[model samples]
Target: MSSTETVRAGSGRAGKRRTPGRAGRAHDTREAILDAAERLFAERGVGEVSNRQIGQAAGQANNFAVGYHFGTKADLVRAIVRRHTAVTEELRVRMLARIAEPGDLRAWISCLVRPATRQLDALGVPSWRARCLAQFDTVPALRRIVVEESVATPSMGRVLEGMFRLLPGLPQEVREERGDMSRLLVVHTLAERERALHAGERAGTGWEATAAGLVDALAGLWPAPVTTRPLPG
Candidate 1:
């Protein structure tokens, strides 16, 4: 039995034959709602989807099921992001531990890029998470939730620290620009791949190949020379 399945509320053979109790059923409902919401938000923008649509997709007869379980759209978005990040966090921690060369820029970049690509790959085709996350960039408020749930995590912090340690000469402004650039590169690239995969179209070779390409681009991007100019008076 799965971890969630182990929470049987009744006792004896009668209990075994009995349907899942309230807690287990509620857990299942929440997961169903999350799954439906993630796909809807991915297919449509976060702002474009409604709680009623999500609840209906999840097979809930009650119109307020989404609001009851998840509260608001932002809360629902956070839940979806957290669900995926939890897995990617594990992937990143494991990748961080295996880095034999702490000074290699590509090694650190791989730590940043691979976890996300690998997570999307593991989700297989038809998964909405990457596309859903891409939509978060369209809205500032929702974007912050994405940052908090994924980029602000401890593993991500370590990856950034290691990446910056090697670029000691980078200007603060350029560093900030490169940070945003790298984030956009990773998020949209994977999202596009996910979109293609979902549509049965080609999406490069695979997630590993895609990650290698990103690591290469980022390695060069970080160390590129910056041309400073005077600010307007």
Candidate 2:
């Protein structure tokens, strides 16, 4: 082939390759970016990492990764929140299906906590994710996503609502107050214990051991109101 013809052929191939038709590749790239962001954010803190850093962690060739896929840092935060929500949803479904009739509040609450605690156990806060969740409260965009998607999503809320119903009767204000505290206690314990375990403290025995201890501690905040059994009618 003539040199000019060879050059033209190569140019045509290059143009075709650059036609921006990599839907699957784009999807995979986006997924990788979020995975890295979550790992980093959970380990470090959202403020400690940048989009360029996230791209690097994801093994991306370009530094403009998060922008290319998610458009903004806040969007990337939402993406991570969505991933957590997805895991929570899977557990929520299991809890919903498994909670027996005449459900014990403690047992039902366990269903919600057990799966998520597993995620926390497996995660090491990886610097990025730890930092991110730590700073997560100050980030308006990210905070909203965390509460709406990651925290109070429907299934979990319903579980909490049921627990509220079974709670020892308190004034409306107190019930609401304690209800929120009880749920937060579970989340707080999971995060705090995970942090401790990451700091090299041994988690007592197995998961049941650790979780049972937590259950016992948090259970103290919620007690059934004691009253005299009414005489038979």
Candidate 3:
């Protein structure tokens, strides 16, 4: 039944049950659409996948179901990103509370990396969320949504503040440059591992190990000497 449909024919007990049943089914349908869209968007680029295709993959008889639930392509993408970011945000918040040493670069870097890896780990194998986000990050508009939802959060602000406090001498240009590099490294690296795990190929290590390596690299990266400064633009 569609979300708009009402079970008016039933009485009392049956009516109460059917009302909740309809809502339950609608919630299930929305999740089904999200999962289908994530996989399709990951396997095929966001521009390549149509709403009709996502609806079909989600087993929706109505071709317009995607629009009905998500409104537009950007809305759909934002929803997908929120699905993951919300979980990661919670993870980061807890990790933040555990920070005994605000000066520990590794601690703060782990705050940045481990939440994502832990979320991916909880998602199990054959997942496409990480790869879907990687694809989205390549598009400027979609990348903004990704960053707005994931990076521009209160917990993330604290993480960046904690991390940067240790590197007071780093040049602004290099800081911004390395910031971009860190994002790319974490995103693409996890996406690659997710791709490999989904493809039954060698992923080398689990999410925890991957996160540890990323944390180690980023720990070194933040403090590395800036040799050449960019010419004034």
Candidate 4:
């Protein structure tokens, strides 16, 4: 085909997809609703938002729009978590596959650590804008949903337990505590790194350079226990 023909074909495809009213399928509407929900849930805490509110924000007729895609408010919460959780899931599967023998601490730690520590470049996570949403979320249910749907996946917990067993200098309880802390630390790091990325973009500087600096900073915070004694009272 000629270059002009190719350009026209591509534009035709794009126009059809973007014009949801003309070409929209049930799945298209479902995805659009989810896209809207993800932004709203991330921006405003779940407690502060309701099913009716989500439907309105999604440009739907009534609360039924959200219910059609996801049965309940709780279900919608899970869907939102799934949007940001996908990369972590893929990373886990790939990392775990490499450690086929299982309980391979070194390889698995990268799986456990990499998802939250680095920029999600390949995926469109920058659009979900996870860092900002997570930082602002104060609703207990949203936090609980993320923890259950994303953090508490079976393989993830299994690898963490293996890490605890392999690294026995520290008690299992402390290791578990650190594991929990690691999740919070990851979220905190993302919030700070994302803020820097935004600032750099606004300043007309390269974002990749800023991302590199953030990665180095995250490496410094990895799970080496502090043996320093507490200060004397």
The runs of at least 3 residues in candidate 3 whose Cα sits more than 4 Å from the true structure, single-residue gaps closed, are 1-21, 230-233
RMSD of each: 6.4, 9.3, 5.3, 9.8
lDDT score at residue 218, model 4, on the 0-100 scale: 37
User: Model 2: per-residue lDDT, tens digit, 1-233?
Assistant: 23321112223322423225555565676778888887777677778888889888887756665666676687677777676667768877777777786357677567556766666555544323433454565566666776776667778777767666776465565566665676556555555665666666665544456577766665566664545545559
Q: Candidate 4: where are CA atoms >4 Å away? A: 1-24, 84-87, 99-106, 116-119, 124-126, 132-138, 198-233
Q: Which regions of candidate 2 fall more than 4 Å away from where they truly are?
A: 1-21, 101-103, 121-141, 196-200, 224-233
TM-score of each candidate structure, all chains considered together? 0.88, 0.70, 0.89, 0.65
lDDT of 4 by residue, 124-172 (tens): 3344455534633445666778778777897687666666666668755
Error of 4 at 9 (Å): 38
Model 3: C-alpha RMSD to truth?
Answer: 5.3
User: Could you tell me the TM-score of candidate 1?
Assistant: 0.88
* Residues forming the 10-long window of minimal summed lDDT in candidate 3: 6-15
lDDT of 1 by residue, 2-93 (tens): 45433232342233233445666767878999999888888888878888899889987767767776667888788888887888899999
By how many angstroms RMSD does model 4 differ from the true structure? 9.8
Residue-level lDDT of model 3, residues 1-233, one tens digit each, is 55454223224222233356467775777789999999999999899999999988998877777777777799999989998787899999999999998879999999999999999999999899989999998999999999999999999999999989999999788889999999999999999999888887876668898899899999888899878655779
Error of 2 at 195 (Å): 3.7
Clashes of 4: 0
Global lDDT of each model? 0.83, 0.63, 0.87, 0.58
Query: How well does candidate 4 score on lDDT at residue 58?
Result: 68
lDDT of 1 at 67: 73
